[model samples]
Target: MKRNLLILITAAALLISGCATGPTVTRTASDEVIDLSGRWNDTDSRLTAEAMVSSMLSGGWLERFSTDEGRPPVVIVGSVRNKSSEHIDAETFIKDIERELINSGRVTFVAAGAARDELRDEREDQQSNATQSTAAALAAETGADYMMQGVITSQTDAIQGKRATLYKVDMELIGLENNQKVWIDTKEIKKLVEQKKNSW
Candidate 1:
């Protein structure tokens, strides 16, 4: 009974100390602020966005828009192939590019098949007695002129008890009407970490 009482007292004291100190808040070692770190598999999405932006400008996509009588180009987020070992949300990257392009006022976003369905439904409801017809009804709904698609790949290498990770993201925009690829983009990002030794 005495030993049990002493053990309970020790446990209580340790718990009190732990509560007072609280848990440590670990911070990333590198000075560079990156997207959420850890073994997340969504790295390709970010890389894809970066590559598309660079390629769009370098591939003269904006020039094409200007040549088309200043009519903003329409883009649709298409399938982004995740060929990596892990699954990732590629739509997030597509959405990011779409958001940026729309905000730039140089491009217009064409709703995807799902969005088109909802838009048509809304237009039908308003067609009965509306003060004004929607833009969708006024003109032939222009389908997306360009579709964005991509693939993600990865590689792992180890040396001197350390491991390095490499990620390659490739994307392209193809003209829908003419079946010609208008833009091609690629981005690569890598990270390395050393293995930790066990403490004695």
Candidate 2:
């Protein structure tokens, strides 16, 4: 009976202590650089997209396509495969790439993937449900002249609580009509983290 009472007292004390020092929450700015776990993060994605797309736009393909096609080339983001072991969100990276492409003003950006299909569905619904003047015409979608696709790869090494990881983002822009690779670029980011000696 005495031992059972002691266990109950100890459990209650521990629970109370835990509640007294519970975790705190604080909000931070979106652009703040906070690397808590040394994983593939937003900063890496944004930087990679900015550098790679800038270089891609400056390539000879842009001038050649503009001259041959007599207009700014339309581009669409295809797929950004995350081959890294980490569970990185590829869509976020793809958005970053699309943003850079659109903001550059050097190329015409077109929608791709399911979003394109969603637009088509909406157009079809409009044609059936709305007036001819209000409905958007079918088969008017502008096809992309070039498609960008790529993969993300990573390597990690650790020794004595010290860990370093290197991520490589390789991307390529290909001519949609010819399936020819017009521009290819690779950007790399490395991070190092050390585990605290007293994990407790």
Candidate 3:
């Protein structure tokens, strides 16, 4: 009984100390560069997508397609396979790429995956619930001329208390009609993380 009582008292004291000296939390600007883990993060995803899409827009494929079709090519963001060892959210990356593509005004963006399915479901629902003029017509959806897909891969090297990580993202634009790879670009981010000795 005495040992159990001592253990309980010790645990309570540790918990109270933890609560008393807990870490600080504060809100900062969203775009602020904070690398707590030196892993793949939102900043990396957004910046990489912006750079790659900018390069893709300047590719010869865009000019070729424009000359042949006389319109901005309708593009869709396809899957970005995450083959990295670390758990990374690919949807956030995809959205980042889509935003850059749409904002650039160099291509027509089409809905894909869940968003596309929801749109179709709404269209079908409107057929019965909405007036004829208000209902979105069927077969009016724009087909994507090119599909952009990619893969995110990473490598890590560690020795003693030092570690280095390299992440690569490769994206390709493929002609939907012919399965031809029209453009490809790669972006890389490298970080060296050092574990500091406990100051206390």
Q: Deviation in angstroms for 109 in model 3?
A: 0.5
Clashes of 1: 0
Error of 3 at 104 (Å): 0.3
Best by lDDT: 3
TM-score of each: 0.68, 0.87, 0.87
> Residue by residue across 159-188, what tens digits does model 3's lDDT show?
777889999999999999999999998999
Colliding pairs, model 1: none
Candidate scoring better on lDDT of 1 and 2: 2
Worst 10 residues of 2 by lDDT: 191-200
lDDT for residue 6 in candidate 1, whole number 0-100: 100
Q: For model 1, what is the C-alpha lDDT against the true structure?
A: 0.69
